[model samples]
Target: MKIIIILGIFLTSIANAGEHQIPTAPQKYLDMQNPIVKMDEQLLKITSRLYKRKCSKCHGKKGDGKGYHAENIEIKPAAFSIPDYMLNRKDGQLFWIMMNGSDDTEMVSVGPGTDIGLSEQQMWELITYLRKEFTK
Candidate 1:
């Protein structure tokens, strides 16, 4: 039984090794930053709940990408806890991703124009929360 558990853990790591790559966002998005300041506690709360509502189902509550539906999906949710990954990705890039889902994966867009999607400001708020809370 111990061997089975150990094997399972090893296989899981192997399964995720080089599973996917973060695509390059356009130059326009790469240079952008969150316009809102980090000290905005009120807005952060709102965005936190929004993250829970829209993203936590896949990205996990703590931004670890181990949510309830994580195992059942093909595209792995990004592990935002990794500062290296999150730090390099600009706010605009992340915001654009939230607005327009990944082209090569199952990251469906959650921004405006969709029937049930986030508005521009709401998307920005989400990014703010991610940067302030998770990426630190």
Candidate 2:
């Protein structure tokens, strides 16, 4: 019984060691894909229009936090052009923020049933545009 338990522990340790080993070059290549080199112009136009209709009231036309309605609000909307703030956030995080606006800030969920009512795909497009435009 002692020998069996020792062998089991030894085998488990070996398996774990192998699992943590650095992956091969081919494996790394398969893990990642090339990023989209260019934005789709048609999608850009659609998202731009959506931004104008929904976001321009708070984020401004250029996403610089200078929208016409911004003066009345206590908390200023995020300036999307700021590289420091834009770089740390992931696309998924941005999507979540758009779908469920920050609790402390004036930003509200622009998703369905809300005043702005943006679809999931539309929010994704807006995220893509913001990431592309803001992140260097």
Candidate 3:
């Protein structure tokens, strides 16, 4: 049993060894800026809940991408807690992923028209929250 567990962990590590291959956002999205300039208490409260509900299952509460569903998914969720990872990604890139999702991964569209129904402002707020709370 111990061997099995160790092997599972090893395989998981191997799976996550490579850098993520997220596509670039369009020029328009790349040029966009985050409108939310602040991370007040109220915003944190709201965005935390949003993250817990929609993201924690895969991204982990600590933004480590080893949440409940991470083991089952083919592609791992982004690990925002990694040093300099979040800082390197542009705000618009994050926003585009939240809105349109990735084609190669299971991440589905969560924009306004989708079932998740996240508005543009809400996505931006989540981006702000992620940058503030997860970036190492």
Candidate 4:
């Protein structure tokens, strides 16, 4: 009986994983806008390299969330390439996630003081790259 109950709970968690992993952005972040107005080729090149180094391990090269590490991770990375996925999320939401990663998953804070330490401008640039390259 206990085993069955545990299995039920575990299965329920897996079924609802998506709902659990996405952290809510504070109103401040939610209200914020992307400062980057345009993405030049030079900026794209820089952010692409940054993405490859920091994000591709889990989010995948094509932003499909099927990177080599994705299989072993308990919670899957966000699939940015999914149709309208990037469109629905606010710029602030995306920025907040990168700045303060979800606590329930492997995504970590990549902004300011984190070990991966990305500047605000760099993070915004990455968001620009995501919108341009991954949005379907």
Top-TM-score candidate index: 4
Total clashing residue pairs per candidate?
Answer: 0, 0, 0, 0
In candidate 4, what are the lDDT values of residues 1-136, reduced to their tens digit?
Answer: 9999999999988788746658779889889989997988888898999999999989999999999999998889999999999998888998999988888689999999999999999998999899899999
Q: What would the TM-scores of all predictions be?
A: 0.79, 0.65, 0.84, 0.90
**TM-score leaderboard ranking:** 4, 3, 1, 2
* lDDT value, residue 95 of candidate 1: 76
Among these predictions, the greatest lDDT belongs to 4
lDDT of 3: 0.90
* Residue 39 alpha-carbon offset, candidate 3, angstroms: 2.7
Best to worst by lDDT, what's the order? 4, 3, 1, 2
What number of backbone clashes does candidate 4 have, counting pairs of residues 3 or more apart or in separate chains? 0
Question: What is the per-residue lDDT of model 1 for residues 16-123, given as tens digits with 9 covering 90 to 100?
Answer: 755767666788887877776654677777888888988898889999888888988877898888767677778878877776788767688887888547888787
Task: List candidate 3 segments past 4 Å from native.
Answer: 1-20
lDDT of each: 0.79, 0.70, 0.90, 0.91
Off by over 4 Å in 2: 1-39
Estimate candidate 1's alpha-carbon lDDT, on a 0 to 1 scale. Answer: 0.79
Candidate 4 regions exceeding 4 Å error are: 15-21
